[model samples]
Target: MFKLFKHLAFCAAFLVAVSASAHSFKIGELEVIHPHARPTTPGIQNGVAWFGVKNAGASDDRVIGVESPIADHAEIHDMTMDNDVMRMFKVDGVPVPAGETVTLGQGNKLHVMLMGLKQPLKEGDAFDMTVHFEKAGSVPVQVWVEQPSAASGAMQHQEDQHDHSAH
Candidate 1:
């Protein structure tokens, strides 16, 4: 009886953890998954947010805008290497192809620039933001502040150790 109870407890805890990390928001035919950002240090006025947009509809959509209470303003920006120099520029919108997923985050060259941050973003903290889609309308998302490697599972084996030391 004690072993059964222990097993059930473990399963319950596992389910909760999985559900908490699998958060996503849907608007129209678009699904926004796991909006997240990295922790910002003090005196930093700028930060970036990243997420993946999956379009399930037949037509393509575009991410036009982003609004967050944690920042003075936000804009969609893309990075490119030009003449051996890295350049970041503001874009009107990011195209999300039909039946495809576009990821905006580290190494993806696209991200949401949160300008004039109201406060420093700390690990384990969460903030609310609205992602505007051209065809899907606006979708509200909760962005989690986590380490890049941990959130993307680039260091999955060290995730537990990282979380323990980070938090």
Candidate 2:
């Protein structure tokens, strides 16, 4: 019967729609287009992953959690400055609002701390990480390991030189 065929087609279409949304984790007003990540060290169990998140939407969103297979733990961390001393702390989340971009960069050092890595992360290698947003759910970020050299990290505050200079 025509009605029976129409019912079947409708059910099929509905199932497809649900699956499309279920497959991806989303971010605020952004698509997380081709997300990439890289670790900090080579031949070491400890590592970090950086991502370039661009806001494609009109409103902002924040990152709250990170999940990955490389490590038993993935912590959301931030660097804090106290007078002449600098320290790192684990934060619950990070905000990347709409119409703006947030880069997980070196030194100012917001990182995805990969603890208990099965193996060392090397440059030119990429791995999978799922970043969770307050509203965007969990989006997968592909991370690659690239060491930050002295030329880059040394010129910056470096976290090694606590000169107490107020520039």
User: Whose lDDT is greatest here?
Assistant: 1
* Residue 72 lDDT in candidate 1: 93
Model 1: number of backbone collisions: 0
Q: What would the per-residue lDDT of candidate 2 be over residues 82-113, giving only the tens digit for each residue?
A: 77576567789878888887766533567666
TM-score per model over all chains? 0.75, 0.64
Off by more than 4 A, model 2: 1-28, 31-43, 82-85, 149-167
Task: Give the 10-residue window scoring lowest on summed lDDT in candidate 2.
Answer: 158-167
Q: What are the C-alpha RMSDs, in order, of all predicted structures?
A: 7.4, 14.4
Q: Which pairs clash in model 2?
A: 25-138, 26-136, 29-57, 37-142, 37-143, 37-144, 38-144, 39-145, 60-97, 60-98
Q: lDDT by residue for model 1 over 48-163, one digit each (tens)?
A: 77888999999999999999999999988766555655556789998899999988853466777788899999999999999999888899999999766544554222222221
